[model samples]
Target: MPFSTLGLSEPLLKALADLKYSEPTAIQKKAIPVILSGKNLVAAAQTGTGKTASFVLPMLEKLNTERKLRGKRIRALVLTPTRELAVQVEQSIRDYGQYLNLSSMAMYGGTDIEPQRQKLIWGVDIVVATPGRLLDMAHQRALHFDELEVLVLDEADRMLDMGFIEDINKIIERLPLERQNLLFSATISDDVRALSKRTFSNATEISIGNNNASKPKIDQWLITVDKGNKSALLSHLIIEHQWQQALIFIETKHGAAKLVSQLEKRGISAESIHGGRTQAMREQVLNDFKAGKIKFLVATGIASRGLDIGELTRVVNYDLPDQVDDYIHRIGRTGRAGASGEAVSFVAKDNFRNLCAIESRLGHVIKRKEFEGFPVKKVVPLSILNYVPKNKR
Candidate 1:
């Protein structure tokens, strides 16, 4: 169904048209009407399903038709887990609300607080922030939640995983008791469900796609290589494909930095981003990579959630994540917005168990293909034989 038939205001419909959004995604179609009806909602949707617009567009419409705040008080508060996500949501709000008089700003740590304080002082219609920094500002009397009309927890599962539950609770306590709440998560874990119970009363629930939906558009394949030659194989593949842009995921911050250095030594324009880097640096690296100034971006789990890079051609898993769901999120970086893309993973002998676990969770084995020159022998190493496949043994 088209977004125009969703009972949206004429201005919002016009804004969506200008953005060239011809159709409503499943999540958008299900959630928009419920949200517009002024009901609290718990939405489960995977990344790249246009979940951002499901909430942003409806919220913008509500704000446009409702009363405005009188002072420097925030009316809508969006809490995200990372600085990148906060900036991303704020930008969407600005884009959707451009036709209205609404104002928005993003605040997070790893930067000077003075400028953020100034932005709060000047007033904004919506504030997108990380919990820690927002709490600090609230405690210092630099911000107020008395006028809050809606509270949104974007990436709610990630917030719980990052141990931000206490911060989230504190922020909730500061807000008025009668405000509306919306929770959005890629996957609804037990912890997230419990949090939703406390945050929303009589909430409507919506799920966009299947729990194990396969992004058929993404061409997925695995390459088995020796642990020592993994980096060499990656460098060779990048050069061989002549890919203009690729986002590579590693398991650790240290690993990301080391890989970036290795790629740079081979004359590849690359940069690394992770939790250890300052927010400003992370933003710069992401911007540069998206703009094609850098050919490759190496990141850890930080880039796996709520980050949308348009038309990403390929995603490389340099090292497998411990959790099966993370593997799904890592490869989801590509094949976004109806664009066909590719995902390649390097699985070494030591990571065979992880590969098996991933296959079990996916309920199907991922096809393995060997590169012509970079062949891996079928025999299993004796020491790690127990972890290898029975057929290989």
Candidate 2:
């Protein structure tokens, strides 16, 4: 359905049209109306299913009316888990709310607090922030939530996984008790359900494209090779497949750097993004990747949640994620917004357990393919569904 049919104002529709968005995504179609109704919402959809707009569009429409500001008060507060995600959400707000008079900011650390403080002096209409940084402003009396009309927890499950529950509670405790609340998560795990139960009131719950509902539109496959032959195998696949672009996931910052160097040595230029780099560098890499200036991006899990490349066609696991859920987020970087994509993984015998956990969570075995010269020295067994995945965090 069109966004106009979902009760959004002309300005929002115009902005969306300018961005070439022809229709609402499934999450947008369901959540937008519920949000416009001013009711609490608990929405679940996988990454890249347009979850960001599901909340941002409706919230902007609801907060388009101007209100008198006092003591740095914001009308809507969006809490995200990572600094990158905070920046991403605020950009979407600006992109969609450009024709409106509303103001928005992406608040987070890795930058001077004074600048953020100054922006909060008059208050923005919408503030997308990380929980710790949000609390920092709260403690200094920089932002007032007394007048907050909407509270949105983007990637609520991720925030909880990062152990931001106390900060979330503290922030929620200060908001007006009778405001709209929305919780959005990629997966509705047991923890997410509990969070919704405790936080949302009389909310409409929605879940789409998860588990048995259907697997995402990604052609997932893996190649089993020796640890020493992994990089060579990747280079071979890139050349053989003639992939225009791919996002490769590594396990650590060192591993990320090493893989990029290896790719460069093979005459394929690549860049890496990880927590070890400064925020500016990471942002630049993300921009380059999106702009197609960089054909390949090697990232750690840090980029998995926040990196939104609309046309990213492939994501490769140079190293399989130890966390089972990360398998979902890493591959989700591709195959976004109902587009077909591919997810590739390089597995060594040592990664057998991790593979099992990931496959069990996926509820199916990823097809195995092999290169002619890259023979597996140690055979990797198929996934045994009952294997419990352990989070090394």
Candidate 3:
């Protein structure tokens, strides 16, 4: 259905139209109305399904219609896991709320706190922040949550995985007890449920898909290759497919750097990003990748959650993530916004356990495809294979 029919105001609708959002995604269609009614929510949706807009749009409408907040006290707080995600969420809020008088800013670590403090002094209607940085500001008496009307935990599952649960709990304790809470996650693990129970009262739970479900639009394929030849296989596939832009997922910062260097040696424009890189350099690499200056970006899981690269043609798993949930998020980097995308994984014999775990989480065997140059000669002996269903084997 058209966004106009979703009961959004003319000004907000106009901003969406200007942004070329013709219609709402499934998550938006389902979550927006409930959020507009000022109810607590627990929404689980896949990445790239316009999840950001689902919350941002309704939040804008609510903030615009509600009583305005008095000086500098934040009325809305959005907590994300990483600095990039905080910035992205703030940008979405600003973009959608441009026609409104609402003010917002993003605060995170790895940067000077004085600038964020200065911005907070001027007053903001919404504050998007990482939990650590937010708590720091609150502890320093540079920020207050007394006026918080709405609390949103964007990517709550990731926050839990990153060991931010304690920080999240501390932040929640500082907010008013009667405030509305919204929690969104790609997967609803046991920890997510526990956290939601603590943070949201009588929350309406919305699950768009089964937990850790792969995006249907993504064509997933697995290729078995020698562990030493992963880089070579990746380079071959990129060259074979003639991908315009690809994001390669690796497990470590050092691996990302090595993969980028290898790709560059193959005459491909590549860059790497991880926590080791300065925030400015990370942002620059991301910008260059999005701008098409870099044809390939090798990144650790840090880039998996909130990095939005438009029309990403391929997502290659240079190394399988240790956690099965991460496999879902890594592949989600591509096939976004209803675009067809490809996900290729290079699995080695020794990594069979990881593969089996991923298959178990996906509830089916990921189809195997042998690359022309990279062929599988033998099946790896995975102890987990004994636990697989006969049909799956």
Candidate 4:
């Protein structure tokens, strides 16, 4: 369905056209109407499904139609899990609401707080922030939600997992009792359901796909190699396949840094991003990678949450993630917006358990390919066989 039919303002529709968005995504089709109805909602959809635009569009429409709320307080608040996500959401708001008079800012850690304090004092119509930093602003009286008409939790599951439950509760306590509350997550677990019960009042629930399903457009494959040969295998594949741009995932910040060094030695330019890097460094690296200035971006689990790149066709797992859901999120960096992509993993003996857990959770065995020099020496079966097919063994 077209966004115009969703009751958005002419300005928003114009902005959408400028952004080259011709149709509303599934989540947007279901969510925009619900949000425009001024009711509480709980939404579930996988990554890269236009979840950001779903809420941003409706919220902007509401702001355009409704009379300005009282005070210099925040009227719309969006809580995200990480600094990167906070920045991403704010950018979307700006892009979608450019024609409107709405004002929005992103507040998160790893940046100077004084400027944020000044912006809040000057006033803003919307604020997208991480839970902890928002709470800090609240405690300092730099932000107030007494006039808030809408509250949104993007990636609710990730916020809860990151131990933001208490912060969220505190923030909610300060919001006006009568307001629209929306919770959006990739997966709805028991804990997320319980949180929704506390946060929303008789909210409508909408889900776009199978709760734990991976994107069907992503082609997943794995290569079994020894721990010592993972770096070599990754370098060989990138060089041989002439991979110009790929998002690589590692288990730790140090591992990401090390992988960048190894790839550099192979005459491939790469950059690393992690929690330890300054916000400026992370943004620069991400921008460069997006611009094709850097072909490879090695990141820790920090990138799995809300990183989005245009035409990101390849994701390589130099180190398999321990959590099956994390594995899904990692590869989800590619195959976004209905585009076909490839997810390649380097599975060592130590990652056998992780591989089994992932395949079992996925309910299908990932096809394994062995290269000439990198032979699969040790066939560590899943408890002597589970994810590995009998024919392959």
Q: What TM-score does prediction 2 earn?
A: 0.67
Overlapping backbone residue pairs in candidate 2 total: 0
For model 3, how does the per-residue alpha-carbon lDDT over 211-257 read when each residue is reduced to its tens digit?
Answer: 55633378998888887778888878778778777888888988888
Q: Encode model 1's per-residue lDDT on 1-393: one tens digit a residue.
A: 788888888878888888998999999999999998999999999889999999999888888855656656888999998888999999999887778888899998768998999888766789999998999899888988888889999988667645577789999988898887899987666668889998768999887776334333688888889777788898888899787788898978999889989988998889998888777787788788888898898988764444557678898888877877677666766775456889888888878778878877665567777677776764323223335576764
TM-score of each: 0.63, 0.67, 0.67, 0.67
Model 4: per-residue Cα lDDT over 101-170, one tens digit each: 9889999975889999988875789999998788889898887787788999998876764546667889
Better of 2 and 3 by lDDT: 2
lDDT of 3 at 148: 84
Worst 10 residues of 3 by lDDT: 377-386
Which segments of candidate 2 are over 4 A away from where they belong? 1-38, 42-75, 79-113, 122-149, 153-179, 183-201, 205-215, 303-305, 386-393
lDDT tens string, model 2, 118-195? 998887888999987888899999989888899999987667655566678888888898789999987676767887
What lDDT would each prediction earn against the true structure?
0.81, 0.84, 0.82, 0.84
Error of 2 at 224 (Å): 1.7
Tell me model 1's lDDT, rounded to 2 decimals. Answer: 0.81
User: Which 10 successive residues of model 2 have the least lDDT summed?
Assistant: 384-393
Task: For candidate 4, give the lDDT of residue 105.
Answer: 94
Candidate 1: list runs displaced more than 4 Å: 1-38, 42-75, 79-111, 118-126, 130-149, 153-179, 183-201, 205-216, 303-306, 375-393
